[model samples]
Target: MTTAPKVALVTGATQGLGLALVEGLARRLAPDDTVYLTGRDAGRVAEAVRAVPGGGARVRGELLDVADPEAAALLAGRLEERHGGVDIVFNNAVMRVGPDDDPREIIDGYAEVNNFGTTRVLRAFGPLLRDGGRLIVVASSLGTLHHLAPVLHDRFDGLASLDEVDEQTAAWRDAVKDGTARSGAWPGFVNIPSKIAQVAAVRALAERRRERDAARGVLLAAVCPGMLNTPTSALWWDVGDAATPAQGAVPLLDLALGPVDPDHYGQLVRHGKVVPWRP
Candidate 1:
């Protein structure tokens, strides 16, 4: 008897690292496996599905703006109805546009789509993940403590506790209501906030999974695909001399199809190595 193929869903697969991930996984996995390639642009998603090097028949496209609650819900419903459960869920979409009419407005827009949109996707589809399923969040090193602490110190008066950070975030929202929110303080890049938020969310999910069952066998981990020569980092793409999209796909693919280790759950893997995020 033939075993059923694994089902994988990758968001923001239309271009850049995300597209490379879809292609890499499609080439690696069996032809019977299924890959749900999602992008906010329908045409782009379709194009990505067709662009996979091998097992094109196993790839399918879906127009999903992950930040949209209705869209996430619809995608979750469709997955549940068709696949029963998803074996892997890859969160890779992000928005980094800046120099808005107002800086605060730009920050809010980035948080809405990058942070909140990712949360929505996790919440919507997390339950449909199989017992041993894997959740791969494509994060960035910029969000790591080593990087964020210095940036936070430069921006704020002092190092704030997580609660204090939440309070500040809330205060920013309140200030926005009164039209007093400051924009100069918001980080311009898309990776920083989104990666930080994704790391926190993935850790929380891992904890919840453990509490649900120590033997549940599910794995959730965030990965920094490294600075690739993608559009997302086009402005600074020349700064450090980035790697190719194929090179960037190595770590992501390892997280998806490689060995399973409970100890590695909730950790951040980068450049083919596992890095400690917290002391």
Candidate 2:
């Protein structure tokens, strides 16, 4: 008999890198496989499911807003009841930082959705990832250690637990509010610091994942898809005619459906390969 088909899920799948990722995954899905596409807007989710390549038959829509902790739990329960568990989860839902939004709004919004929101999603789905599964956090190269002081770089590399990760991000937000973030090397931008927190969360979760469940084959990692020119890019920052989201989606998709290797677990991938995150 043939094996059961895999199940995948993508958050913030309406447009941009999220949408690109959905399309890329759709093209590779086995006929028996199903990939869930989710976002806060039901209409957009439905529309996205239909618009993605090969999505009509294989993609399922779920109304989910990652910022809401309850939403993750609710969706997790449904997945447990419906599909038993999921094989891949891509956490890409993020709150964009407007050009003129207050530092407080920028910092707090990023923490709530990008950091804590990702935290909730990971916790909610941690138990539901099948053996030999993967959880990929879509991050940005701007979050890398190249911008941080060596001390801070080591600190991120050595995050011991989730609580510490939470505390660390909170401190950065506080620094922004106090007008010291610039000097502190955080610089008060939503994308970089938020992605930093996401990377830390991946490491934090990877450390204790097996203790909670014995399957022990889930790979938790973060990735910084190179700057891409998408509809959403101009709203945040301008990369003059940069790589398309389709080009960016390749690395994220590779981690989802590539040769299984334990060495890739808990590392930050760039362009489909694990790279030195600390440098």
Using TM-score as the measure, which candidate wins?
2
TM-score of every candidate relative to the true structure: 0.82, 0.89
Give the number of the best model, judged by lDDT: 2
lDDT of each: 0.70, 0.78
The per-prediction CA RMSD against the true structure, in angstroms, equals 4.4, 2.6
Residue pairs whose backbone atoms clash in candidate 1: none
lDDT of 1 by residue, 1-279 (tens): 866678998888888788888888888888788988999997777777777777443888988997685888799899889988888889888876633335445656666677666777877778887877888888877655554544443322222232333344445445554455334343444455446556666665666665552467777788888778765466555635788888788778887888677667777778656776543
Misplaced by over 4 Å in model 1 are: 98-102, 149-190, 211-214, 237-240
The sequence of per-residue lDDT tens digits that candidate 2 reaches over residues 1-279 is: 866678888888888888888777778878688888899998988898888766322888999888786999999999888889988899989877777778765677668788888888888887788877878888876666766667567556668777788888888878887778777656456566777778878877777764443355667888888888865677776878688888889878887888656666676788767766676
Q: Candidate 2, after superposition: displacement of residue 17 in Å?
A: 1.1
Deviation from truth (RMSD, Å), model 1: 4.4
